[model samples]
Target: MRITLHEVSKGRAGQALPSMSLEFHSGAVRFALAETEQRPTVLGLIASGRMKPDTGRVTIDDTANPKELRRRIALVDAPDVSDPHPDITLAGVVGEELMFAGVGATPLHARRWLTQLGYNELASTPIGNIDPAARVRILCELAVLRDGVDGVVLVAPDRHGGSPDGWWRIAGEFADRGYAMLVIIGGSAAVALERMQEFEAINASGPVQPLVLEAPADADADADAEPADEDAEPELSAAEPAEAAASGPWVAEAVEAPEPDPLEEEAEALREAQGPASSIEASDTDTDTDTTENGAAR
Candidate 1:
């Protein structure tokens, strides 16, 4: 898959964003780190299929509907558990997402993905009960469920705080699988080096500004921004054994049972109370997590 951007800009709060352009091709992944003040709107555009060059054009090859294009390109970011069910288990969250994506209704696929991404033990644990790193891993699994996905895009504030090494291992696996990925992180030379070791490039952006520096000079300067290196390995540590178990080899277990569908239950209740409406009003809201520039919500 190929993603082409041309002078695409987004407006917010009555301000036109700075024009930006870029291209991402198959077999190559890009890494970018931007401050909250200078993040670009490219990710939002890509996620929403609203990427259009102000002076040129943005074309995606081999895609029909831009909305369905998400199936081929997965965007992973921090978990948003602000909804009513913060106590839902990781497995439950994955199941819900799969069902929403119309992939499958079984937990088996979710279990395998969580395991492959190294979050198997947390499969049955509520999302809010886990630490930040575990939550990030679950987010990654949720973003990239299908095997043949064209690309994976991830946004995070910082990777060094929890387990920098573990992040690299996972990113490396995605690269090895020929999945083009774009990771956004805070300014850190060490993090950039680690990402570039596996990714194709390390770009920069910010929240207030739409400019994206694809080829940043002074690569060493970013390294200075990293915190003092801790004894953390570039792999999962003993502190997170459940994470290890979650990423362990998949084991077939007896299927427990089935549960009631919440949507169906709601529909049933609605019917019981009153006759259903002729048609449900469709929502046009963009559901991509990358809708925001940097960490600031757009």
Candidate 2:
């Protein structure tokens, strides 16, 4: 399945945004490295099927009504539209989703699936108590469990301190099942992920261009600020010298690195078990080729 946007534009009469074209395809992973507002708006329009491109159109492979496409297309972590019921348990969330999709699976079935998926410990935990990444994974599974899901669009999934690698692993799992994955991000995270141009889109006109995210004005100013001299220290007033000398020699307090959160550690472990399929090029040697080749061979 594929979702294509041709010169899509939204917003005010003359101020339509993202005037660029985009496409998302099945069994592939793609990202939209855009601004905070731009990513969410475009994601909302695409996922909700309310997006009527002023100059272009969005089409699904075998579907006409975008609203009906909701069953096959899932949206995760989109701003203002992805909050699950906090009072529900993890299993309860799955059960509710199954019901929504008209699947007759019982809550016990949801529990079993969670256990098989290495989330047994969280099965009975309240959705509010679990990590947001876990919730997003559950939501994605909900889409996959439905009869005929084609793809899932994740909007700013990194917003809640969620792991990009974790979602990439989960997307990989679904992609293995022939489902497409669209990951949308903005700001620093978008810049960080801008290098992942391996996945191709159905409607791409040319080569994948590097996403150039500009630093905010204030951030650039801070970056360009001159550094202070190494030996320079602010001078105390002459009148306060005696007081400073009496005050125990200005001992510096040591700051300790914070202990890792157990919840996050468990989430990381779970994500690892799911298998990370994507790697950002942080070092000199290319890890993407290695990971992708290994994954493909498997």
Candidate 3:
């Protein structure tokens, strides 16, 4: 599969994309998640080929219409489940997707994918009854049907329902089968960084790009603060050494230290000085009470 974007820019409500251009080819999997307001336009370019730039062109295998070109490409968008036929079973929906792409869906392949994705029990259930994660898995399976498959595109927000290991496992499967993937996401930099690291760790040869969506000016301030705010919290693993270093000297110094608060020391001293006077007052009061009782009896 080969993809090329030339100065593709889309605008909405006064903001425009950064006049982006990129390309992806076979034997390489490129990952990018849309951020900012351009997410929809980016997705549109991938899905319907409707968001093409006025000044430039997007070509897939030399075809101008990405959607038409996607016939040879397996495209997976999780939200596209909204268009699933109400009466179609989960397996049926997957079968239809494969069939529409001119691929035959063997029962074995469908069952394997459904079970691997934790959707085995819902294999016969309607698409509407299946959960989002299951839908995502179905889309992933469709992306990589058999070895030597032509092209595949998978798009979803980051933090999809899967453990880190699970995510890497699926990604690895695609890479192993030699399918190019495009991931659309809305998440923090840390999350995106972790994803890129996962891709590199699995296949050192894979191509991945973190496309940060530029938020509005006011929103960018808040987005910029998120990392700093997270950085302020000390990690347990990191703080332990610092704590030990600080404690050693502090403990030694504290051993010889006087009262830290002068007012507390003064109050303690005052209480100690008043102790004898209070005891004498108590004795005098007891004697006066005894004398008063004796006088009353006489």
Top candidate on TM-score is 2
Minimal lDDT window, size 10, model 3: 249-258
Which whole-number lDDT from 0 to 100 does residue 67 have in model 2? 71
- Tens digit per residue, CA lDDT, model 2, 14-124: 254556667778878777765745556565556446556665566777355777667667776566666566778888877777786786569787878788778988988
lDDT of 1 at 152: 65
List the global CA lDDT of all models. 0.58, 0.69, 0.58
lDDT winner:
2
lDDT of 3 by residue, 1-298 (tens): 6777776666653255555666666656555545664553355454335455655677877778655554555555544432466568878877766665466677666776577767788888887665555555566676555444465555553434444344444655665676655544555633755776876787886666789886799887776774555435333456466556446533434334455898888999998987755445544354554435557732
- Whole-model lDDT for model 3 versus the true structure? 0.58
Q: Model 1 misses residue 79 by how many Å?
A: 7.3
**Model 2: residues >4 Å from true position, as ranges?**
13-17, 37-42, 47-50, 62-68, 195-298
Superposed on all Cα atoms, the candidates' RMSDs to the truth, in angstroms, are: 47.6, 42.4, 22.7
Candidate 2 RMSD computed on C-alpha atoms after optimal superposition onto the true structure: 42.4
Candidate 2: clashing pairs of residues: none
Question: Which residue pairs in candidate 3 have backbone atoms (N, alpha carbon, C) closer than 3 angstroms, thus clashing?
Answer: none
Query: TM per model?
Result: 0.48, 0.57, 0.48
